[model samples]
Target chain A: MARVLIVEDEMLVAMLIEDVIVDLGHEVVGPAMRLETALEVVEAENVDFAILDINLAGKQSFPVADRLADLGVPFIFASGYGAAGLNERHRQAQVVQKPFAPDQIASLLERL
Target chain B: MILQNDTPNIDPFRFLGKDGEAAEIIRTYDWSSTPLGRVEEWPPCLRTSTALLLQSPVPIVMLWGEEGVMIYNDAYSVFAGSRHPALFGSNVREGWAEIVDFNDNVMKVGLAGGTLAYRDQELTLHRKGFPEQVWMDLDYSPVLDEEGKPAGVIAIVVETTERVLAERRNREEYERLQNLFSQAPTFMAMTSGPEHTFEMVNPEYQTLVGDRQVVGKTLVDAMPEIAKQGYLDLMDDVFKTGKTVRRAAERVMFARTKDAPLVERYVDFVYQPIRDERGAVVSIFTQGSDVTERVRAENHQKLLINELNHRVKNTLTSIQSIVTQTLRGVQTREEASKAITNRILALSRAHNVLTAENWDGAELRAMVVSSLEAFQVESREAIRINGPDLRVGPHAAMSIALALHELATNAAKYGALSFSDGSVDVSWQLLGDKFELDWIERDGPTVVPGDRKGFGSRLLLQVLPLELQGTATIDYRPDGVAFNFATSLEAVNDRPALEGV
Candidate 1:
């Protein structure tokens, strides 16, 4: 099992997502609730892949997504808007529609 | 051959109906220079034809004998264009030298026992002082003597210059309108009949549909894809009812390349019926514009709202998960469930305030009332809310709401709200960029400071500071419990405070 970074703003949502990650036998890194913290964790933590909430609080998680892409880290976008909400640069990136179950995260991680 | 003295006494002059100015001119004309001798000397066929020509209501002329001299009616004087009285007995070549070549054809045909007629013939005639253009309908027929031989050419002329020019102008105007119709910027098409055949389409439509063979083809025949998307039905409905149809934005999948995926597009369009003079629908004018970009931007905004809604739903799910997970790790289920339900209810109250303002934020006064409103005493005097209105973002509002709910719950159970003499004053102040809220309880049961790490203690003393990105402290005195919290105003919603009393 690999360590995964969880970037979600809603505290309970972030916790539940961490629970799902732990349930899948993976060590979770910073479940950052904001874009700045997510970027800092992505830079500081030794993580294999990232689970990015497209909207981190009021700001977009695009900088974190872009930073992860620059570092050649595989990541999946978790958004309620599905793939259409993504920009042209991340159009082909893996997407997990929001309010996802633990197995969907596991499967996405497996694919990554 | 001059007929000055024998003008009114001659057989043809006196024998025929010598009415009108043309007859007077002819009876007195000097014909010595022309081939015709005189009115009295003209052959019987010529004399009889001259009388008919003079009495004609329409313009008429006679070019008689081998020399082809002119003799015309008064009506013909107008067609002669100022070549009137002098032209009555002048040679046709000498009088109308400008169009003599045309007259030569007429004379050659008429005198050779062939009739020649021209309708609305355009010719320039030398008349008055200038060579003028004129259109005329002319008929030339040969007249025969008693021996049945072709004697002279009789011409029936009617100038139609005004009518011809008017018709030309009308045709030119029609052509100009046609030019505009073909090149208009907006997509335009005219479809006729139940089949909605494309009667005409402009260049915009041609390019829009990828230059498909649309004109002279039915709508379904031209583009079969629209039939599946209810477009065919809509068009049929509009045509049958003659009612206009306008779609603000419709998504269409256009297949631009073979074997490739359908390209999605958005368009705003209208179908307007064109009626005939009888008020019957003859065709439909289809006009529209591509609105894909605007529609996409609108959908993006909708997605953002939907994401917010999803977050709300997910928060509810998370609360459920918390309650269920806490049940597995708790000492008393009833107390834990009660506390969880109460906290969740407070969060919902905060959400209600935020929802009312389109999720932008919630006011602190409203948030306070919503959090403690459920634990209300019989009299409103038990609780005093005094604060300048503060709007805080959803995260901070939720934290503040839960903190107040916990404090109020503790007061109701053990501090102030449990007794009739109890009262709680909730107040807040904004100093520079710092926002601070205070809760003071009085005239209640004696406070017993506990060292236990209960859910209420952890929630009130720790969660408020952590959640709102602020700080909080609680003090227990002999009379009641008091709490004070401070946070950055910027972290809360940034709206002007309502004037407070």
Candidate 2:
């Protein structure tokens, strides 16, 4: 089982993500919702993969994404606005539209 | 004096008596008797009745008693044809049956002892041997006898077909030019001589002048200032050189009426010399149009686009701040979930501000008032706001709104708004294109930002710059937390306040 990190502002979404990861036979790490807290988690914990929300509350999670990249951790993005909303430089990163099925999430994680 | 042979032939020479008698009669007779002699000398065959016609270019016919419309010596006998033998003794009517009515009219007028003159008359006559349609201006005068009674009629006729046709063609061309001038859309005028005196003006030209008399007057006499400004000089140059001078897209300002606003116009004109037959320049023609409204509209549209760009940039910055601050507030799993929802709702509210102005910009005080409404309802006395009427762009509004939310959340949880004794003061001042806003807390529960970094601190320090392109400072005073923000005025005014939200 892989250790996965959930960086999302919404408690329900984070929980749903946690459930999806657990169902996938993966261990869940801290679901750091804010940028500062998420960065802290990335630095302290050994995260195998991460699921990041483009916007956490009012703040973007780009800093967390940047830190994850530096740590050589693979991650995917989940946004209500879809892939077009992401900047061009980060567009290559995998993204899942919101209101996604569990299997879709599982499939994306498997690819990653 | 009948020098003819002693034969039975009736000698016409008896009518003249003898050579000396005929010579004496001719000498005493008035050579200047006919009115035609005033403009033209009589031809040598004027007194003949046999068939005398003068026809160098213009055919002239003179008929005397018993000559049957005798033509001058130069007149062709073909005009008489088969009737030539009988024409010597016959009257004009019997000799030329086709011209009987015309002959009768002239004969009647001559018989009444009056001169008959027809300026232009069309006549088809079988003269000599050929039939031809001839236009003639004829004058018939009677020669009186000794008792002052009519005896014989003398005809003076000039063919005028060529002159009449030429005059008709000239009139038609002049009418066509007038029609074109009247229908022209641009203002057109003609000025005479180097003095540039207005000679003629079209309807559009009259309308453009608007209450100014522009005919038969020099430009200086009509508008002294316009003449002084080298307008006359241009006309003078065209006249002197006999060359056309064209002025294209020249800007000019004029008042429509005495009390009307000055209107700007663009004029395109040509001053060409109107030369006489001698090829000397005499006048100049000018034409032009007015284009003020179109030019003004183009400039106004450009300004509106620039204003739109400024507002959009500010809005993006505000959204950035809201997202950053909301995420900072999320602590536990439950709070993190709630914070995201609240932040999105706040962002939607800001979007409403954008929509109100159709995304142009927003009001300053309104943005602050709306953002604090949620926090204000829970605690009335805890908040105090002070600022004059102001406007902010969308970016500034969003940043300020998110920043205020953070302060209020913290105050409600552990700072000033947490207790009845605590209070918060929000005040702002304008400084050029930027506004300085201060949020100070007083009489609150023992003040401290928890040692661990919180969402409020991160928003006040780091997120403001990333989002608003602005700066925010927070002072951890023992009394409370004091926060100051400096941002662009465009950001504050670009996002108008949301209504009914």
Best-fitting candidate, measured by TM-score? 1
lDDT of 2 by residue, B31-50 (tens): 34433231123332333321
Candidate 1: true interface contacts recovered: 0.13
What is the CAPRI rating of model 2's predicted complex? incorrect
Q: Scoring each candidate complex against the real one, what DockQ results?
A: 0.09, 0.02
Q: Evaluate residue B267 in candidate 1 and report its C-alpha lDDT on the 0 to 100 scale.
A: 81
Estimate the Cα RMSD of every predicted model relative to the unseen true structure: 13.9, 16.4
The TM-score between candidate 1 and the true structure equals 0.55
Candidate 1 lDDT, tens digit per residue, B189-262? 89998889998888877766674588998988877887777888998888889999998888887755556677
Docking quality tier of candidate 1? incorrect
How far is B434's C-alpha from truth in model 2 (Å)?
Answer: 23
| Candidate models: Cα lDDT each | 0.77, 0.65
Per-model TM-score, in order, reads 0.55, 0.49
